[model samples]
Target chain A: MLINVPETVVADALRGMAAAHPELTVDVENRVIIRRDAPVPGKVALVSGGGSGHEPLHGGFVGPGMLAAACPGEVFTSPVPDQMVRAAAAVDSGAGVLFVVKNYTGDVLNFDMAAELAEDEGIQVAKVLVEDDVAVTDSLYTAGRRGTGGTLFVEKIAGAAAEEGQPLERVEAIARQVAGASRSFGVALGACTTPAKGSPTFDLPAGELELGVGIHGEPGRERRPMMTSGEIAEAAVDAVLTDLEPRNPVLVLVNGMGATPLLELYGFNGEVQRVLAERGVAVARVLVGNYVTSLDMAGASVTLCQVDEELLRLWDAPVRTPALRWGM
Target chain B: MLINVPETVVADALRGMAAAHPELTVDVENRVIIRRDAPVPGKVALVSGGGSGHEPLHGGFVGPGMLAAACPGEVFTSPVPDQMVRAAAAVDSGAGVLFVVKNYTGDVLNFDMAAELAEDEGIQVAKVLVEDDVAVTDSLYTAGRRGTGGTLFVEKIAGAAAEEGQPLERVEAIARQVAGASRSFGVALGACTTPAKGSPTFDLPAGELELGVGIHGEPGRERRPMMTSGEIAEAAVDAVLTDLEPRNPVLVLVNGMGATPLLELYGFNGEVQRVLAERGVAVARVLVGNYVTSLDMAGASVTLCQVDEELLRLWDAPVRTPALRWGM
Candidate 1:
């Protein structure tokens, strides 16, 4: 079971986050984390949120040059509109606020309602829906692809563009472009047990694999007996490559599904890189770790984001976040 | 079961790390990773190593300021003296080299042998033996406390001191103080599967935990029924607090086992913060994530390092490494 009190997980986690990172402000009552330097005049504010189970995602992502504010809900649940509305209003400058919405129905509905409410209250709100998972056309959770690790690419690229003092429209375009060019595929070695339900989210027998699995333990393409890591990495890379079809260099993120070891992820990364190189794809940049994760799920997802010069420049730009930081 | 071929896991993982991070050099022939600019004259180079399964430890730590070189052995096995000898020689600027070693018998023995070999070759070598685990006075695999997450502290703090161009003796002294002042304790919810063994190193019942567990899955203080996250955090904090009679601010690291989720670790961190606050310990700096981990083990370790201005300054100094980087 996930190591937490089922009743007070989100609020408790937010407290520790505030203690560890003094650079951010945690409004525990409203359950929103905002960068201390938020609401910079004339600069577009980037906001992201979803379930709280995915740590270092929307909340840990809040800092200078990244997400201005993050609204965290309960585990694998969406934050309410009030939290989002407050975060947007607090971080919104004269320029505007961009909501980086992941493409889950709950998140979309809440964010949409919040955006409308914010605008009515005189806050300019724009939204970019992140739905870059190519693993399934439809899954157990939603009608289309469920948002996955590629949302990190959208956040980072969009955050960088905003850091450049770009207008809200320009940052939204960059975020949408990155999200559009990204594709992710994952494999689950085992199921993760949510704390509320102290059991595996799904059942997969020993030595079996769930190819193209969703982040929140949604069903995947098919179940097959476990294969060698080389074979598994090849499958994930092949799925992502088919969707990408990029002739240019790409940024590769080999994200762990919470429970997997860093070594295994890196081992998987070697095979993915080999396969990509053989397929004539140059991985100019790579991130190998858990950025987005399913809670304690044993598996990994590979996200390939096709990057042009501008996207690559933004990707390489300095960012200072609790989770992902570089060159700052 | 660990997602790779059992025979070539360490070497293959190293290949991926080298590719993902081009800032360091991989001496595949020697199974050692060295900084490209190693052997900088008059600089006190630092070296660290142990088993290979623990990623981002020795290898991921080898970069500009952290580790000058990291030798990798087979899974859960100590690196040979030859590997350590080569690493120390390679990174020994005229100022000499310091090896940050865990307190494991194998690691201590190998590093000791390597120090002799390096000294025989006219390259002075010093070492800091980390024995910071405060869970027990003795453990299954060790005569005294077993070095765990505190090794990362010794490495980081010493690396920073070395980066300041301190003499070898000064750097070693700094490492020793950090190591001696640190205390760690871990609890394992499940066992980890070693690649070569292809099975769990130990067994835990459905709702039991191995408290005060070692990173290698060695037997701990005792087995007990699984408790709530708040209970677990409290137990761990109490253990560490008894070991560290802190009268000043501290550096805290709530490290995750390989398979634990970042969210749960942060959840645990919250309880830890509450416990620490109740105890009146001021946490000056904090880090929460998977730094030192057992391969695929579902657990977490809490390390508390009593720090003064000097140690805090060294920790805050610019460090450029694959595993840990901030303000660089």
Candidate 2:
């Protein structure tokens, strides 16, 4: 459904998130940070957020091990500067705060503005913009690339790095390195309904699926006839592999776009493993399921991250987010 | 798409699962137990299983705080007697093992046969059949109500009781308490496509949704006109409330039927909360997301557990399953 009530969407979503996760405390009045606990004194806090629909994204990912704060926006829309400023202030420790943002025009602009505002408050602030989606490379009238699935990996790896007492610059550099090594490509079998409008964002026929569809249900570069599970897996993995060139061992994520089945995801992951093995790429780690979703759209995305020894070790570090937690 | 390959479906799926969760081993050749660590030497082990399509249900739920073994069946079809026999043997400690069987006829019969077989080996065995779905009251035609979402809660709570060094009878009692106090009702917005069939299990209209649908995409108690989020929530919650008089604070689960969004689930949870409040029912805990699902059918289920102080404590205990983990 096309939900048009953009003004209250972010606030309402945040309220819902806070209610769902009692561990998270949201400053609903000011659209500030939602944290599991107050930032540790003298610790360089980490704050992140972007669009709303890709939930459990910045919000569910917020906790002790990951984000100190998350600022949510409307569905597929960027959060404004005020929300980011509030989030930054709420999470700023004496050591400083770092902003981890996706590479979107509105997100970059608003986060940049928030960083400046925080600087005015005598808080040291640094920003790292994630541009990892390989779907779009170059274009006028648009950002260079859209940040998609890789944001999760970067947030997690960087969050671990920060938790280990890394400085803001070092954390930002590690996050950028993680982002640079990751690439994702997705396909949509159907369009999602924006909650307010109560209608689908786009029309897709029963037998047709879009290749390389954006998370916002935006048109992909190609619309092809429906293919078998293996064919679709081949297409998606090929796109991600060609873009990322994972000649070494890599962490693979076969993520569902909201409405796909875990069965299908596993099936797709099997195909991905086969294809990667055939191409002589070792699968070091694999995560298959709904990590980052685009509402209830029937689709899936493949993400590949080439990992050196250090990257793999960082990936193995304990993470304790509500969505992804292991080891510790 | 429907995929028919009855003979290989379960094994293939298990292979994929083992690959995805390297921490858990899948005995594809023998349908045995999966343990993160070696089974306790003298403890009464617990093993469970049924149909395979319920990803993360009995399988994803196997870990530290849950099952010692899970026997998977073909897609939506129950496993054969031999599979259960092997499962029972694999996890049998010197003390014995408990079989947590769902209420389906195939599951009960096969598990019963397995129990008999295990008895032949002089192995102590106990079985607790779970029938917590409130959709059906009569067990004449279908061996009673089909076990649904309540199985997870029962298993977790019972597993906790077992982990606490409770005897077989005590663990069984706790499992029965969970089953007796819990009730679930599901609605399917669309039919699930069996991988083998490549077509939906059943047809659904564009705007209509089926209420009380089964996990295997079985026809629900009713297929009604599509309504607002509030209306659907009211209907689901009403069904659960009517089935059980939950006086104490209750744990409510708003579960997606594979294809629904967390946004809609949260919206439904809000409506459910409002309805329960109108009825003076207090919600002690709430979990919203795709916990148990039927492939990619767009729908949801609501589960209510009447919790007392003990059950609440059990619910609060740490669980380390792949799907539901908290506290720890």
Candidate 3:
């Protein structure tokens, strides 16, 4: 691991974030990162968080047109309810707050508790759970489908709605709509080693791959020998399209799982586009890079969200975050 | 290799770029990506290219405020002169063009030949060579320092100048100034495997790392047992600051070499900032992410460029590229 102390990984990263981006107020003590201009008077605030490994998803997405506050927990562990409640209190204005929770056992439980706590404090709170992973009905840490790459789409689109001064109810509806309309599938070429472990999380032989791996290295559908990018794309896209049965143009996300370079991800995306075209599916937009990730895991994930004109417009809106920024 | 065929890796990635970014006209056959709104009246055009592996370097950087055109060669090889000449002709308005060439011998030679060819065709051309890697005086691919992470800084600030309608001479001078004022040092935790070779580029045993490594796995100053991020930051910052005794504030770029995760990179950045503070160097701005890369090598490089007020203004200028986008 390229870290000084495994236990201090999240805190150290927060300090670095504070230094690199003075636009955000990083509370290392509480493990929350909030936009400096948070608590916009008449705007609904968006909050999302989970374990620490999947970066740029929650913390890096905190800015003007995205998350207002992100609570990062220890690596692969769910954040406590206190972090979420504190983030809500810090960012919530009179307009209320929305919590975007990924559907993991611990995260869902913790966020549910935080929502109750926030409401007790007289802050109106709404919740949207993202469970767009189509790989399994249940996983190691999830009762239902695991939330994977589709969380990015939900955050981005819903964030735009919030930034435009939509009420908390409308923003929650948009977030839920995005989560329900999206599907994701991941394949792991190799395992990731957590800082505390100092070794591979799972045994993934060099010549084999996990076809539908979970983000936390959970067991997937099956193991297979190495496949070409085209083959992998065909399987992944088919997995997503079959389940989604989208009637509208889809936004495509070709995401890297930490260690996969853009070179390979872009090549894979080309194949993915070919497969989608063959299926006569129109792609509204395509994003190719790492957004959601496992720590140094060699793999890639494909996420597709069926978007309406309104959702597409929101996706195109200006955002000014650290990891994802444009149109500012 | 996450590609259909090793020989067509670059082509496949280009096709994907064309699909992803409609604002950039990707010429797969010509191996160049140009802004769709090229030949912007009196604006000086910025052109850059190199081997395809260091992605998002030249190609992902083509947009409104960055390079006007980018030519991509096969992995680990310099682009030919024809591509550069073609790009020059396509984007050269009456205001002329500037070529940002890295210091690899093949790149320098090919760009030189292309500059002469473009001049013969009645196109005004200026050149700035980036040789900012302070690891070794000479290495496997160059006679002087190797061009690495500092290329991002040069492209950004110089591209800002070009976008502001600076003459070709001024843009070239700014680029040269940035290249001269910058220093970079890299550390590799592991070796990268190229698509063509389909094997590790070099041997890096477990529990070991290479300090002062080049972007392409070139031999570094020494190999030692793996060090903590703080220790590594101390050595890297020392290497850069010792050679660049700047009297002005510096912009810091903590760049990932493909396989390193943001989690580790941010933790490492924290350590880097501590060292810079201890050394009493004020940082005007900092960028953290993968801008330049070597396939999927697990490592990072730190780049520091001294900045004056004008240079800082240019650096803060809006850039709307696929990779680096802000202030737009």
TM-score of chain B of each: 0.98, 0.94, 0.99
Tens-digit per-residue lDDT, B66-121, candidate 2:
77778877777778878777766766666677888888888888888888998998
- What DockQ results do all the predictions give, each relative to the true complex? 0.67, 0.40, 0.81
Error of 2 at A146 (Å): 1.5
Candidate 1: residue A58 lDDT (0-100): 83
Task: Give the better candidate number (1 or 2) by lDDT.
Answer: 1
Per-residue lDDT of A36-80 in model 3, one digit per residue for the tens? Answer: 998998999998899999887789999999999999999999999
The clash numbers for all candidates, in the given order, read 0, 16, 1
- Mind giving the per-residue lDDT tens digits that candidate 1 earns over A97-160? 9999988989999999999999999999999998988889877767798898888998899999
Tell me the tens digit of each residue's lDDT in model 3 across B156-250: 99999999999888999999999999999999998999988888899999899999999899989999999999999999999999899989999
Deviation of model 3 at A226, angstroms: 0.8
lDDT score for candidate 1 against the true structure: 0.87
* Cα error, candidate 1, residue B308 (Å): 1.5
Query: What lDDT would each prediction earn against the true structure?
Result: 0.87, 0.77, 0.93
Interface RMSD of 3: 0.9
Name the runs in model 3 displaced over 4 angstroms. Answer: none
User: After best superposition, candidate 3 residue A218: deviation in angstroms?
Assistant: 1.1
Ranking by lDDT: 3, 1, 2
Better by DockQ, candidate 3 or 2: 3
